[model samples]
Target: MTTEAVLDIAVQALMVAAKLCAPVLVTALVIGLVVSLVQSMTQVQEVTLSFVPKALGAAIALVVTGHWMISTIVTFTTDLYTRMPALVGH
Candidate 1:
């Protein structure tokens, strides 16, 4: 492929990756921030407090978005597989 085509493919792949990870990452970020806030307010320096919420948040996110995540990954994989020959100049 040409340089422009390669870059375009890379960009598209990155965009898809970001989209796939967004829900989980956002959940983790929010949970971490909230837990940090609570810890600060209560002066609780326990490391477990931070970890539990983040883990729970990630689990909840996975449960809720599991289908979407699976579909997104499957679609990406299928698309890539179907285009493999063309990508390889077959």
Candidate 2:
């Protein structure tokens, strides 16, 4: 409706997106760091070692946090949809 309202919604969307993605991203980052450290210590230079663990960590994070992420997104969407008429000044 108003510029402020639009900006507020945009910011909220971004915040929610970041919140939903944080767990997976953080898990992958940590796993990669650990794998790299291990590689450095052991002199094991296999690329797959780092890649596979990070991928699996991200997947497991998704599995564990999937419901909360979906619920947040659904609630946001539903709230937006419910307010559409008012947002349009109808």
TM-score of 1: 0.86
Q: Model 2 scores what on Cα lDDT?
A: 0.94
Model 2 CA lDDT for position 47:
91
Give each model a TM-score: 0.86, 0.95
User: In candidate 2, how many Å is residue 14 off?
Assistant: 0.2
**Alpha-carbon error at 47 in model 1, in Å?**
0.4
Model 1's number of clashes is: 0
Residue 18 C-alpha lDDT in model 1: 95
lDDT: which candidate is best?
2
Give stretches of model 2 more than 4 Å off.
Answer: none
Q: For model 1, what is the C-alpha lDDT against the true structure?
A: 0.87
The residue-by-residue lDDT of candidate 1 on 1-90, one tens digit each, is 567767877887898899988998999999899889999999999999999889999999999999998898889879878877877787
RMSD of 2: 0.8
lDDT of 2 by residue, 4-36 (tens): 879988998999999999999999999999999
- What is the number of backbone collisions in each predicted candidate, taken in the order shown? 0, 0
